[model samples]
Target: MKAMRVKNGLKISVIIMFIFMYGCKQSSYKEFVMADAVEVSESYEIVEEKEMTYKLNSNQTNVPLNLKIIKTASSRYKVKNIVTATRRIKIIAQKHGAYISDLRFQNDLYKKENRFTIKVPQKYFDTVMDSVNTVVDFVEYENITTKDVTEEYIDIETRLKTKLEVKARYETILRKNAKTVEDILLTEDKLRIIQEEIESAQGRLKYLTNKVAFSTIQIDLYEPVEYKAEPETYTKTFWDETKQGFANGWWYIKSFVVVLINLWPLLIIGLVTFFFVRKRLKK
Candidate 1:
């Protein structure tokens, strides 16, 4: 009897372990499927029908990104053009937005800053972004993307039409007090899908419209200081100036001595030039 009891206990423990393992595995698979799936379906029959009609197709499509890469500022003229283009774009997209940059002071010295944005044709994202690097002062970063949403656009159109027709039918049934429980559930689901698709399409159309209408080019400009030579100016009475010069010369001599005392390196070079340069070069 003791042996039998022990055996039964072991069997129960095994069964419990198996159940826990299976539950964990099932949960993991569910998560994996959810993460990997597309939110919308591929069956775009209604969307296609609407496309033949007078409906917009943005809901089915998404942003196709064309990121720019800039290297050396090869042409100042191009930079100027880009600046002008950006200004025009800002004015046009004023209702949408004028994307402004944060004040990024590079260092203690105040530097000249330039910014620009360009909107290339969506189809030309790769080519335009690649060209950006050639005209920029420096390439800070780059991004590029291309997405085809023909299927999504089609799917949404089909769904929206079907839902609308179904909703109309449901209203008829509701007026007659004939909508069954299943009818209500079905109508609710269809309405939900229609609402979702409409929102999705509107968002996509807004994005595409923005892209087509405006192109932005972020630009920065740097100008190096160049040297110029000028004739000397001497404005002094000879005797007075000479005396003043002597004083200034004496002051400089003192300063130089202090500098030499601090910089052994300059002292060594000076001595070498003054003493050894002639002798060494003579050979």
Candidate 2:
């Protein structure tokens, strides 16, 4: 009976040890899961912060955006006098704070024409057009054109912002993460390329803005003159004709003398052969 009691006691002890080991394992598993949860939460917070930063930067950079429109016009008309009309147009353009970018004047037998390329403020485009119309006698044609560049403008702006952000990130990496000389040089080259692209985008934006702010007007002013017929044939006086005839005769005589001089050796050979043949025939 004592041996039986000892064996039962040993089985109970073994069961208790197994229970203690399983509890320890369960506690360690719980601790590991909690650590993973904390890391995941921290990563989510970081992602949310980055998203907020992007939104804030985007809003700050793009404010007061407006539609970009480029206006241009062309007008062709007849005027009483091209010079007078041109002067009047120049004065009108100056009064409206406009300038002539190009001017060309042509005078032919049938007409006189003056072409002008005028740059005017967008607000004064219609006013300038009306002012120019006062000098027109007859309208040949008038054309107005408009181009919308809002999409392109916004697209460039967005791309530029993205490039700037990328450049900033690369700069941070270069400052903090780049360890080798090769890595530093590669980052610098990438930065140079990005800077060139940024400058090009900036230039294009400036051009578009300028075009939107100002308008172009091309004007062609012309004056028609009476057609004067030119003589088909010129009639020379009798003394003029006599002089021309004498000059032609002198030229022919000089040409004949030159030809004879060039053939002098051949002429001597022919004469010698004729003399020899004649002497033989006479014998």
* Clash count of each predicted structure: 19, 0
Q: Residues 1-283, candidate 1, lDDT per residue (tens digit)?
A: 9999999999999999999999999999998887656433343666667786644456435545533222221222223344444454344434344343332313223333444444444444444545544554545555433344445555656765676676677666655655688777766776677567667766765565565444444444433333445559856788998899999999999999898789998878888887787887887
Q: CA shift at 17, candidate 2, in angstroms?
A: 99
- Which ten-residue region of model 1 has the weakest summed lDDT? 68-77
TM for candidate 2 is 0.58
Residue 23 alpha-carbon offset, candidate 1, angstroms: 99
RMSD of each: 32.0, 32.7
- Candidate 2 lDDT: 0.94
- Residue 235 of model 2: what lDDT? 98
The residue ranges of model 1 lying beyond 4 angstroms of the native Cα positions read 1-111, 116-145, 177-283
Q: Mind sharing the TM-score for model 1?
A: 0.30
